[model samples]
Target chain A: MSLQDILTTGTAPKRVAAGMGFWKSLFSALDTPVAAPSSVPADDPLAGYGPQAVEITPAIAANQRLILSTRRDIDLQELEALCDAVGWSRRPVRKVRRALDNSFLVVSLWEQLAQQRRLIGFARATSDHAFNATIWDVVINPSFQGQGLGRVLMEYVIAQLQQAEIPNITLFADPHVVDFYRRLGFVLDPEGIKGMFWYPS
Target chain B: MSLQDILTTGTAPKRVAAGMGFWKSLFSALDTPVAAPSSVPADDPLAGYGPQAVEITPAIAANQRLILSTRRDIDLQELEALCDAVGWSRRPVRKVRRALDNSFLVVSLWEQLAQQRRLIGFARATSDHAFNATIWDVVINPSFQGQGLGRVLMEYVIAQLQQAEIPNITLFADPHVVDFYRRLGFVLDPEGIKGMFWYPS
Candidate 1:
């Protein structure tokens, strides 16, 4: 019987074989944790050359510039490497590429030294294009951490969303860096809005 | 000077007119709460006919069916009425329509009574179509509350996402209904995933 028939007639449907346990397994598949550690050590060559450093030798500072771009044509392998540098487990490159392509906007920060540019920070957001947007997978190259680049990247991303008139901004914060977001004016459980999730049995 | 020039040359950019306060105001716009009260009273015609009632009379149940659909072309006015029935503040119909149109999938549940159908529940999800999806604006016409249709609707939505291979599912929940979601195997702060919001300064 159709589900409608079963509902109206109170009759058991033929596909009753897929019971509650089946639904549980479906949710369980969602439980895989995709998280970056709260503390990541600098792991790249430019560790000492972060632009926000208090003191930099004139030669090193003159040629190095940090620039943000909305370019969606991100190099996937490089993104994977950046994620790895910040202690994220390997995510399938194909899935990561699809996520980037489908996102409403992608922002990348580049470190340019002389003629070479390296992808040092990245974040992307998905939005309804009018009402709300949530950022995902925000990461900065470990070599660029603690240099105020995360704040700059976040400021640029929020500015872009506001420019589009998407008024609501949200993100899933790892416990270790909740304060980092709080410093940027992010509130936890604001007006009783709490995040919920479902996982497989 | 361009932002790149400011960064590399240590020169203040001209538009320094809009400072941190401007950014704060942009985030503040997002602080408008779009929440449904955890306790909503029955306010519609089908208050007595929820299909899952153990004592539902045969006469009452014979002609009524609860059906779920993935129709994206939702009637925005009807949706507004249902949201009103559940005590949500009025959302501008134009923005609501845009939100629905931009969603990856929209699910609606209807109460079919022989010759007539009424919209009774609605929810929509946005997804990267591979790794993650977040459900939004879930509402059950208050008249149909406590009869298990909400659970039924959630199961259908989860099944649809699982079939599509979107493995991560999330939603923002009100404090009052945390247990309701937990009963369905949803965990709070799972693996230290906390929801954070950036609001106006």
Candidate 2:
């Protein structure tokens, strides 16, 4: 049988009456994989490309300028000039020093702005590396907001988590950001799953 | 106003509308500081709890007997005898050793079992402290199960976590045991919240 015939033969209905094979063969001829024309263009926004596209790396001191330029890390005095540019209050250098000691902070700096290497976005997670992980403080610089940087940063963080093979990860999001996370594969805890947060004033 | 009216005055429609307010008033009327409930009653079926209630301590060797008796950590010779009793094959000790070191292994027994006299059920977490905590291999031996020991252990762990102040905690449960955790205030991740597990051969 021709390749098309072979492929179509598999699609034929099983248990046909003895005299119906002829009709089945005719119907099967229409079952070719190529029958439907492709509607998506190479650049179609929704096309299934390979894996998600993004570059992510650990944040380093060298990227400080680009990061500070964005003023997202206003709590860090080193970024005070940038924060001033954006009308943010100057933060104490001691406060910045203390916050930097948390090991779980992973800042992603975009290379294109290397000279200005400000922390355009960052994520922080807490883990014991076996069963649980909690993600917090995920944010993208407002200037970088619409460029999909947040999603890219999140995907990168998730990939890192998958590599670590954590069994469960959880996060809380501002109610307004719920839809953004929902699209990124998060679900709301059910009605009864109350979260109690004790913030240090 | 009646106690019920006082309790119901300023509340959500559901809280006020539900008959729960009546029950709340009844409980409030009878509420008073009371003596602690007796530890698991002797006639309780779960009274089989004995050496199993051995508290976990920084030193674990002293409680070896209790540790070894648990289903998750059955004593090998005893297991062999039980296997012989049930006419099953005797497995190599290496099988148990391997199981103890598996990625799914979360609990870590310490140098001795009685030094501090506090039983611990701990799991390594997957991600960082800000987002989630996944509990794995959690158990308080049969003697400890029904006496709120598990809750105590969890509360201890939770308190430690609160110091870091992570926002969310998550865990997976066998389909049948989900409700037990639900009562402790865990809710299922919405549909499609997949939790993956890998077991070494």
Q: Which DockQ values do the candidates obtain, in the order shown?
A: 0.28, 0.06
In candidate 1, what are the lDDT values of residues B42-96, reduced to their tens digit? 5432333332111111222556755566777677888989999988999888899
Which run of 10 residues does model 1 chain A get worst, by summed lDDT? A21-30
Task: Kindly list the per-residue Cα lDDT of model 1 for residues A2-96, writing each as its tens digit.
Answer: 32233334333111122221110001111123124333255432333332111111211455655566778788888988998999988888888
What's candidate 1's DockQ score? 0.28
Instruction: Highest DockQ: give the candidate number.
Output: 1
Summing lDDT over every window of 10 consecutive residues in candidate 2 chain B, give the lowest-scoring window.
B12-21
Candidate 1 chain B lowest-lDDT run of ten: B21-30
RMSD of each: 24.1, 18.6
Error of 2 at A193 (Å): 8.1
Question: What TM-score do all the candidates reach, one by one?
Answer: 0.70, 0.41
